[model samples]
Target chain A: MAKRAAFDIPDGAYVNLGIGIPELVAKYVPEGREVVYHTENGLLGMGPSPADGEGDPELINAGKRQITAVPGASYFHHADSFVMIRGGHIDICVLGAMQVSETGDLANWSTGSPDAIPAVGGAMDLVAGANAIRVVTQHCTRDGQPKLVEACSYPLTGAGVVKRVYTDLAVVDISGDGFQLVELAPGIDFEHVRDLTAAELRPLPN
Target chain B: MIDKELPTAAEAVADVFDGATVMIGGFGEAGSPIELIHALIDQGASGLTVVNNNAGSGEVGLAALLKSGRVSKLICSYPRTAGSRVFPDLYRSGRIELELVPQGTLSERIRAGGAGIPAFFTPTAVGTPLQDGKETRTFDGRDYVMEHGLTADFALVKCSRADRHGNLVYNKTARNFGPVMATAATTTIVQASEIVDIGVLDPEAVVTPGIFVSRVVGVAEPALESELVARGVSYP
Candidate 1:
């Protein structure tokens, strides 16, 4: 499934996975691939998120939420950490988004929700500096609303920062013209997924 | 300029030009710099490039700057508090100015900046586009290359105490970026929870050498406000 491919992270990928859905990649990354996880608090080579009490008090993900560490993990001063990210040391960054425009404009940071809590940590650097930006999210928000829109009614996180998007139902690649449907979940129709999205989609050539 | 209350906070902040670079000290509510941040906010500054650990709750310290439209660009480790609530978006439709840095590298920049080194190399990003357009070499059968150090025009750091000479000490987790940011900024300004005499602070307890700090503004921060409101939970 295209959704599953998102977790098929390539080997030796120095990836920074965002919170929520993007965090799931740590659990199901294809075996035999040396995928390194980076957290903003200064940890790399992280393992899967531990079962509640199993997490180390010090180790965490990019979100600062408790996580697990694989062997050969190293810690360092965090100020130096940004130097690495801005210096473009990361191969891929998996982020979540509120909206992905037809032309690939991204709005993931601040939603239009008035009560939304305010913050912006290292997302700015990740979007601008990372080699490739992969977005992981449900096709539509939990409210049964389409997140892929003509324009983001919320706020923009990066301008065309997204290279590709993997949802629970489909795989989309944003390019010069608009979002191109690359793949879809097995048994899921292209129209249904396209219907769930407000943006226009062109089917990938067979 | 000289008053019992408003220390040289704003004037010292004057050199922080539009789009000036900065390294801040804070992690969530755990380690925010209260006075120095307020001094910058109160002065109505705009288009700052803040490099720090996190983008705390929007109404919290630096979050207020985002609301004030002063921060045009932000470079930090954790740009938003996760799984809690999304932050107040601060950019236009086509452009996103916030830049995310891996947490470890962010701290190292401050460490390197304060250490007076222009740049040092690390193999952390080898074989990826992250190594694009930079000097690289094979060292000891591995790739270890140079990553430049970051120094800001101004550093807004927080400390637990300060002496007349600007020597500072941090309490608990608040030390997260204070010591490093002091050295990372050309003109480092500090906000202390309390001001003691020069001889009061222990020489060993001074985390930031007074030589790196330019001015000290004294103020205490409020305790963490942990009122978590679950989203989409209907009132029954």
Candidate 2:
């Protein structure tokens, strides 16, 4: 799913990858593509993790993990860092999703459980401000429930904000009409993907 | 003489009273001022309203401050993180109150507070549970929720370098909430790894000007929160 999402990123795009599977997109951005990674905690041109025992306690990513700065990296404060996000300067944002509605609403932040500690972080801002939003996740939950549904059961992070979704079983786009199947994963039939989706799965255009 | 330097961390935070609103700068532990936090803990002020991006990771820094039960309310973006049990436990037990804001909104609120803006409208959190009970207005046919500016009585931040006048330079991504929080607070206290003489730091490279800062304390060998958590060290 990460590789498939990476394929869609245009060269030289300034991208923000949400923590979890989305973070893996950085490693698969096809060779020769010069993408600048943005970590919302205040660094652009974010580099990979430093060598073992060489990490600086102060230089880390939004996930609070030690990271290195690329040669041309630039640092700013939180306000400026968020301006790049909320000002529509960021080109792409790949995020993990808990549920996606047929109309492109994203619900990745909270489960809304009575006892759960609700933490939204930057998910809302990314969805609201990024030029394009992509989600990468499993097609279904561990309990065999569909994550793609007619309406999100969980609380939404943003409304009608997602553009496309890359799942382990297939690639889908959130069209004006609804879920449009773009491609099926190898060995997985369209019927199989459709069976797992709780919403209408429009077949690829001929 | 524009000397903002203070002799010790404890002294820097000595005047913090109970029920004060304080903002501690950090995104996790990267920009966390452990020494100042430790001092705040020792100073024994209670009923603080604290703000930060995340609840502290382990039993150190912000977590230690939370564990001390000094903070009664927390205004932050995310509080649940790996190795973070302090805030969640307190929250679940109905001990600590939390006002969860979106990260960008939180940053903007602080910035607005510093810039003297009372309130602003943003598209973030619209059509979500977070937007519930908030005022909404339509602009260009798009709805935006209103968020009030946030200010604090004190701000605790960590920086890489500082001058006698309190101009600061931070280390990489650790510069997170420091600059903005410094502006939004009445008395911004900073812990610097190195305090240089006046006119030594380049004027152009300073990230935070002295006007926002009230006191600067030198913590040449600041303790790493990750190391402390790794060692299972708990604060006194």
Candidate with best TM-score: 2
**Runs with alpha carbons beyond 4 Å of true place in candidate 1:** A1-7, A50-56, A113-117, B1-26, B29-179, B185-236
Candidate 1: tens digits of C-alpha lDDT, residues A1-69: 223744657888888888777877776777687888887555677777679777543344555455666
Model 2 DockQ class = high
* Per-prediction TM-score, chain B alone: 0.82, 0.99
lDDT per model vs. reference: 0.67, 0.94
> Which 10-residue window of candidate 1 chain B scores lowest in summed lDDT?
B227-236
lDDT of 2 by residue, B1-236 (tens): 78899999999999999999999998888889999999999999999999999889788889999999999999999998887789889999999999999999999999999999999999999999999999999999999999999999999999999998999999988899999999999999999999999988999999999999999999999998888999999987
Query: How many backbone clashes are present in model 1?
Result: 37
Docking class of 1: incorrect
Candidate 2 off by > 4 Å? none
**Residue B141's C-alpha lDDT in candidate 2?**
96
* Residue-by-residue lDDT tens digits, candidate 1, B16-36: 778788777766544566546
Candidate 2, residue A169: lDDT: 99
